[model samples]
Target: GRPYRSHLRPACDACRRRKSRCTTTESSDACLMCQVHGSQCVFVDSDQSRRRKVPTPHGRASSYTESGGSNVDHDDTSISMAYSGETHTHNALSDGQSHHHGPAVLVDPGRPHASAITGSTEEASMSAMLAESGDSNTHIISPAIVDDNEELDSYLSSNPAVGIRRITRTSSTSTNIGPSSRRVLFNTVLKKPLGIHARQSLAASKLEVIEKLLEPHGTVLIDLHTSFRRTYSEHKDRLSPALLSNLYANAMTYWNNSPQLRSCHPPDHRFIWVQANEALHSELFLSPGISTVISIILNVHGRPSTSMFGNGGMVGTAVALSNSLGLNRDCSAWDISPGEKALRSRIWSIVVLMDRWTSLAYGTPLLIHRAQYDVPVPSKEQLAQPNASIAQYAGLSIFLAMLTLTDVLSHYLENVYCISRTSPIDRPPTSSFHLETLLTDWEDSLEDDIRRLVIRGNDLDRAGSGNLRLSYLAVKLLLRRILCDTTNATTENEGAVQARLQTQRVAEEIVLLVQELSHSHLRGFWMPSNGFTLTSATLFLLRDALKTTNRTRNTSLKLAKDMMSSLQTHRVNDSWDLADDCLSNCTDMTDRIEAGRTFESPGMIESQYFIDNNSLMFNDPVLGFASAFDFDLENFQWNETT
Candidate 1:
């Protein structure tokens, strides 16, 4: 076809230069582009005599006429530009409607049109497109829509489009926001208002179990019962979501780790532990020192056997947080209340004690030094007050005694087992004697009530006292074993004999203690005892049974069997596997000794054979039993009197 042309009016200069179709009505003075650009309309000369096709004026003028002449211009190009702009605005409005669940009106009554051309053509074209597309929900911007300033403000305020833009802007810049800023934003936008009834329901259902589990240990470090009560009473005003989530995580961990619960329900500790672990990373509790410490404690307590090294590192983090909060400093000089000061002191003391105990357990270096913190210990008066809650009084005396015991252990570790200054060969024998004296003195200083609790208390009290006594016994056993090892490494026979005798005495003490506690008591005490004392005692019995030929051998073998049987009943971890293997090894050794005597080949029994066979038993360093006795003692001359 030949080039199409508008015979009614020639194209304007700007439209002709752009090769775009242009039309004008009797009402317009310029093309839409020329008018929009504020330029004069100069049309190109065309062959007016030729009859050219003139389409009907289906542009802005007709639409304005159709809309009852609503003061709109007759410019097709301007109407197209306005339509494109409103199309973009319409898409944005649609997105806002979907996201915010609101109406799809694109036009803001408060925002005026950016140009003089009315949007009547744009609205009519959009309506036609929506109708053709079968969309009945399309909202069009009306040219005559008007509102007062207050109404406009209210519309803008209630409009989802504005809120969407604000949200978009915030998310776009969220990377630059700090944790506290993000926390504030989350609290405002994401956190739902949880009611007290719901919180109490959670507390009564799950947190109560946690409080019970924690009550045994919360007397000194954390008063979970009191804290829970306070939180239940003042959660809306005082507790942060992070703290609440952290507490929930801890409760889940306690629930998961409870042996009673595990026996009833299938094992879900891994799932609950992971959930609790993720809550620790939340930004809300990142800066709060006490919550962080509580999280560490719960984590350590949850997996006592597997998390040794990890818990050591967490203890370092706790110490750093404690120091950052000035918890290491004496709070007495501060203007805080005496109760607050006492609580702070107790927390610091707990951190210090935890650092020492974990360091000793994992053979890691201590994080908190004794001289670094001057926080006072809790007074007896504070512990004995009648107003003390169950959580406050439950383990009060035990905790105080443990504080003193941990102090003694810390001193013993520094002086006798200080890795930096001493090696096994370099440590003097007198160091063990010195620590023994100190340990004895420390035990002597314990109150008579504590002694009575350990000797004759019922099941619950006996378990607690057994835990305390086991700790002291473990330290004493460690010292004696160290002395024995150091002395055995020497060529001096006299010192070796003395160290061996002392080790046997300590071992016998431990065996007696273990025998005194029932199987249920031992099972209850297993978690707190860490199996160190039990393992040591079992090793001693095995060694005595193998090395002796007198009637004491029968007693030693019987005791070893009983202890192993008790340990076999409870499966805390792989530690019990080593115990079982030791028991088997002892039974075999006793059988061989009896067989050799019966066959008149007692001299044929060789120490080298026993050493070669039993060396594999203690390959696990945690067992540490293979080196407790010299299986090659046949090489040394026996002294019957010694």
Candidate 2:
């Protein structure tokens, strides 16, 4: 008789176990119940051999094939043959035979748990179990183990039941150093952020670690800045894009954020925690806290909010704040709230420096007004008025201030690299590539810093001194210095001389004010981290010597050049050779450079070399006028006829 047919059918695994029809589609690989539960699919065959029929011990069981072998075996006989064990289990269940392995349904109880299985077969088992679990089970199974080859393996142990399931789950959605050697190294010592305190502690620890990492780089940055400034001053066009970019990037980071200018961090012993969104903590693992903090400053200071404030006008707030604090009136630094006062002040100083940098770089009225010198334009009174929102603009203003920091840094490198050949303290020569290099690099850095400020204004206005802006500005300040011309303009006309002197005086005033601001507010002392003050002081001294009336413009210029040349040409083994050149060159070149001149004495170079390498050119014209005079030519010709 024909059996009653129901509209619904059993699940794939159940059908495979029962050796009956499974209505599930191939794509789903499971019946409706299994599909609802994310299960595996299986089909069955009618053939007696595919049914896992127990054979009669004495002979072939003829009745098992009573349905007819050729007619019962469906085209998909392979599928049923694959699940023959399930068929056997189903047969036993239908026969009411109790099985021992575990809770027995239609599927085989002896089959290993899906969790205990592995490979593709395990996947299949898991799918089958999922199917059998019915439609109600919706818990996402977290694979509790990770791949042995992955970095997570060091921290996450292997799981027998879950195999690498845990690892698979974790790897699905994660943003950090990859699960490789770096991850392993990180996991060895660090723990994941579990709560607020734990995360903050981790963040603080990472910051400290980053600070240490950046210490040596800070020194390198100082040296590079000095070298770049000197080189750029003399050889502006000779600079390379890559080198410029590298120097600029580094300088921008320092100018905007230094340890002295950044936020105060709690000690490692104190409880700490970081929010998950702040994934940047891991980046500090490699960079160090100081570097990271500086990076944040550069980012902030390099881009100020253009919405609330006009272009570089953001610096007005910093100046106002500095003035209010009764610090250096030049807006070198400012103190705000207790927690972030130091960092805020540092950022303000950077902003001021950046404003100058932009003036030099873009050469725009917003920054640079006239061809000869930049006009010190103050902002409108309304903008200087402080409010909570204004504080945010303070952050934005810092970013806008150093947009060209990178370029300035490059210029600084150019100068440093060129003058580095001379004694450290020697006055830089006009034709020695130092002047052009400094101008070009500083100009380029200022341009870029300003552009970034314009673009990042919104971000700065919202988050005062966010990592992005802070990093940008810090790099700029890390690479700043003043370049003074040793050749002062000399004029016999009283009006002309007074005019020149007045201009020089103004320039000197500006320079001195800058220095004073640097020393008092920015703490530009000769510490290992702040050794750039030496270079600044040397330039100021040169400016003073140039302003003197005892020497002609050309004579003092020649002296300055001779001093630098002697320092480079002679071998001096003194710690202060560079400083010595700055002093002796002023005296020697002013007195003598021509043969038979009163300042000349036999072997003057050798005599000075004995005193110090920088003083080797004490009275030698050849030191400064190598190109001016030609001893080899029988008929020497001066291009600029005297």
Candidate 3:
């Protein structure tokens, strides 16, 4: 008779285990068993079932075949097989079976088909196995138990199949796991078993330390202490382990850097840094708000090696987060409280300012385009409200002024430094003239008190005055760089001469400002200033000194030398040796002039030097004037007649 082939499909694991019939109306959807049990009805292929057949004592087993021809005997009655692809296979062997067949899954009669069981069944099986052994000490092999490789050999006797075949476990190597896995592993390994009270105490201690360290600068943009306390009290869930760790890391870094705390033993800053990074990347704390911004700022500012030009992605992330929160839009129409709205406005302003600064520093495109945001600048009265703290008022005032200053910078960047079909080389003279007019207007528009604060350094807070003045000088330098293009002989025209003269005056202003700042005890106030303004001033003075053989040349050389000395004293990260090399060259030229010899220009040698080192010159940290459309200073020739 012909063999009868059943037309009905085989039952799924659940149905088969329950000894119930399984039915599927469609091939793509769940079967009756899955629908009723609310479980996945996975059907094993006919070939797969056939492959699971028990092998004869001499016949090669499927396990052996699947394991790349490794010899494994499957005749042991204690051993069983399971069909789950996601789980590891366990084999148990009877004493009669050869141990030479790969590691055997040890089975207990109490745990019937334990290899094929899971959940409550597996738990019940383990309990029953313990009772059946009577001694209550019978060893039950489980997946968790199998994770220990050292205990593997003692559990099973030598079997060629088991000994030769490696047991795969989850990788301990951090590099192999995803960020989430690494974070989980880090939390598990580094977590301390401190009580809730202890954790709160530790957090309080850290917050105190951070506030003290950050006190000198004052909380300008975001009030870290206030935000943290508010969140900790009311929105505790919002503060994740990552955020706390990052906050601690930032505070610790500041503390460690503090001159007063240099003798104290700090925690492993690197570990805290990694933890903070993990927290930032974790899915638990992606909310865009003051906390996230503070975290970003701390991460960047805490790391001494962090460069303004580098870490564009981190800056971009912050910009994106700010945008997502609609920080770019005016929130007056919203029903939010006045204080909250004010905070948002200030943060948005800061984000925009930072975006522009980074753009200027790295020659990167601006993240916050002027057209995308309409948030009005906060008024001085609004920032100086009675509710605002003294520090807050001071910080916001300076921030507001700096924000306005950046507006001018942003325009300069868009108009002159922007890349387009009409390169800066092709920029019309009127365009540069209009930008200069804008700069002059911006300076003129400054409040009389603020102007006095900048020039006289009296009465008003000096927190942002230096930055505002330096920014003005930087913009002036940028405009002058454009107007004094040596490649265009037209620069020698009357208009060009006027531009050069203005540029010289701006350069002189920068040197004077630097000298003033250097002499003051509040020099640290200007430490936040990049190397751009000073670097540009130095180069300009050096170049002018080289072109002139008069007494003013000596004065220019002296100023240039003085500026370089101040930069060195400040330990400004030179990244490039432009300052040092420029000072050396200026000294040599000055000596020749002093010797009363006709100073011969280096000509192509100087041009090649400028050309080869153009990147270093434009990208100078102190001189944030370099933008995407930077002028080719290398093209400037030493005119025998200035």
After superposition on all C-alphas, the RMSD of every candidate to the true structure, in Å, is 25.0, 28.8, 23.5
Query: What count of clashes does model 3 give?
Result: 19
* Candidate 3 TM-score versus the reference: 0.52
Model 3 / residue 560 / CA error / Å: 2.5
**Rank by lDDT, descending?**
3, 1, 2
Write the residue-wise lDDT of candidate 1 on 276-377 in tens digits: 455444321222334445555545544323444566666787787666545675545332234444545766776777776665555555677776666677
Clashing pairs in 1: none
Best-fitting candidate, measured by TM-score?
A: 3
| Candidate with best lDDT | 3
Model 2: CA > 4 A from native: 1-388, 399-510, 514-531, 534-610, 613-642
Local error of candidate 1 at residue 326 (angstroms): 2.1
lDDT of 1 at 162: 26
- Comparison by lDDT, 1 against 3, better one: 3
Stretches off by above 4 angstroms in model 3 are 1-278, 283-290, 301-305, 308-310, 384-392, 422-433, 455-461, 486-498, 518-529, 542-555, 572-642
Ranking by TM-score: 3, 1, 2
lDDT of 3 by residue, 266-329 (tens): 5566665656665555411222233455456445434332345434676787777565444565
